[model samples]
Target: MNRKLIALDLDGTTLNDVQQITSETHSVLNKLRDQGHIVSIATGRPFRNSHYYYKQLEMTTPIVNFNGAWCHNPSDKDWDYGYHKSLSRDLAISMLSLKDDPEVQLIAAESRDGIYVHGDYVPYPDFFPDGVKVSKQLSSETLLIDPTSVGVFTNTQQNQSKIEERIIKHYGEAVEVRTWGGFAPCLEIVAAGVQKAMGVERIASYYNIDRKDILAFGDEENDYEMIQYAGHGVVMKNGNDKLKVVADDLTGKTNHDNGLADYLTNYFNL
Candidate 1:
């Protein structure tokens, strides 16, 4: 179509199941860049985790990280040049009431700086990585630190009602809590206004591209808004069955099949 910008989600959309890009996909992305299509990444992952893929794609567009809590200028050094914008502090406090159980690991985080893992679980430093991990033991008491947003990780994926109830209670009107996906019933908390849509909007504003000229691809809960906002949103064959209901088009293969790269390669190779 006439799309000039492409906002891609990394984990479930761009990368394969193994969380790596196939050379075919990589090569296609390189070609997309050469063809002068603005490509950027919008993800729920922290900025650091998001960079891992941006580097792989050699992306040159701004990155929307933490579901739009922050945006990074692609031209800057790997993790540098991030701009912060988020919800109010009291709203965060109001959201905490949604926690169903104190045993759950509740943590708020800064995009690249760190996370406060609150719970009985003692997370080792490796869980976070080089710069994002705070250099101290996780606090055991009820934490009030304003992280970019709160996150919950548990080993239980069943009991949908309990999980949804907790999310509704904690975030209710102040914050937005969505159960991203986990066989373990994990949830993600972001400022009410923070989402992939916001990130894409920011990126478009920066480049002056209208929503009608942007193309996006994704296949998950976090991807819903971004995919819907783009002019031509594509969903993968392997994406969740529910998302296909909203896709503008469907790619023929799965990530493992290098579907994304294949799409680009075939288009340009024509």
Candidate 2:
């Protein structure tokens, strides 16, 4: 078989319940890498949070972070095929309107530069281990540059929907808003037309690989584009049914059972 580009989605697809890469998975991926196959991560997580896993897996390729809102080669900072599609500064600052809503807990804008938070509460501390949480709030002075993405954390799904609806109604043309895949009732907003597939394609092009050789595995709404774009998209047994319908194949096991590794072993006969 020809060399392939394997793109992985971190949460609920690559990582197990505890958010660690199991030994079996690590072994299979390393063996594949030793065989000349390329492995990379395409996720909704910011580089701050995903960097550990990238280093843990010992990946040397560019990462698609923030669901393709940012892509860069962390191993080789000199690698120039990087891109960051940020929301306009005006748009980011405009999100401040939601901060005062009683149902809204937090509103944050993130970029490689840093995070600008506009609330008293921090929703997921693990996701922002190095963030400077303050009651200070996001302001034009604090968020000077355009941000790669904006996150609105709400207290409930109903409130989340209300906020999402308002965002779409007002800025539908300029941004893409999605309900984050985590258990938290939050909304993730990125520039319009951005998706994981865009970054994966960029990586494949750099490697001179064709679409037919791209193998991607994912399990959520954010994975929709990449899954459809890959020549072979594998959805886990525990994946969303919407993805399963469009995916080329389905893993017999869930992430907890090392589903990605299982599929690779059988497919490549490793």
Candidate 3:
């Protein structure tokens, strides 16, 4: 059998509603790995937050994190083809300015150094790495170091939409913005041309796997580019409606039902 690369999104895709990988899904992934298939994670989460899952899966492949703003092989120090794109200082300041808007609750920036939270925004300890700094005053000087990604927090969907629109209008040519609805209604801003698909392409190229030999699984707006780029893009039953329209196929079950394992079982005839 031909070796294939499998890219999976964590939240709302690989991890069930409870935020845990089911026993069945775990077994299926292990079986495929043992058979020489490449299984890796492509997620919007940062390395600090997603590293635990990578370790859990025993993945040696480079991980796609921050929605492709960062991709690197944690276990391979010699892998130098990794990518870590960040927003410009000016752009980061422009986005951080949104903290002044009444509708915008908070602004958070993630850099290689640490996470910087501005205003009333307080990230849950579980999601953020240790030594996260909180600043009541966010300025261009404070964000001089370019960040991998910036997050704009808002309470209402309307505000989230407005924030995304404003950001795109101002800096659309230099950056990309996507709303993360699975969690809070927030806008995830990254450098332009950054997407999970880009990360997958890089990893596939490194492994000498053609696009046709790649299978990707995802269930959200952030997964759009990846799903479209994959040879066989499978969307979960519980995935977004927009994703379902563009997906090559739909899984038989939702994430809660071990959809990934089920799909792979039938696809690989396991």
Q: Compare the candidates by lDDT and give the number of the best one.
A: 2
Tens-place lDDT per residue, model 1, 86-108, is 55545544544545564455444
Worst 10 residues of 3 by lDDT: 128-137
Q: What is the lDDT of residue 48 in candidate 3?
A: 75
- Candidates in order, TM-scores: namely 0.80, 0.92, 0.92
Candidate 2 Cα deviation (angstroms), residue 27? 1.0
Give the per-residue lDDT of model 3 (tens digit) for 1-270. Answer: 789999999988999876788889989999999999899899988787788888888888898998998889999968987989988877777776677789787787878646667766553434654543323255765666888988787877567777788888888589888766654567889999899999999999999999999999998888999999999999999998998899999999999999989999999999
* Per-residue lDDT of model 2, residues 197-249, tens digit only: 99999999999999999999998878889999998998888887888999999
List clash counts for every candidate, in order.
5, 0, 0
TM-score of 2: 0.92
lDDT of 1 at 184: 30
Clashing pairs in 2: none
The local distance difference test score of each candidate is: 0.66, 0.87, 0.83
Ranking by TM-score: 2, 3, 1
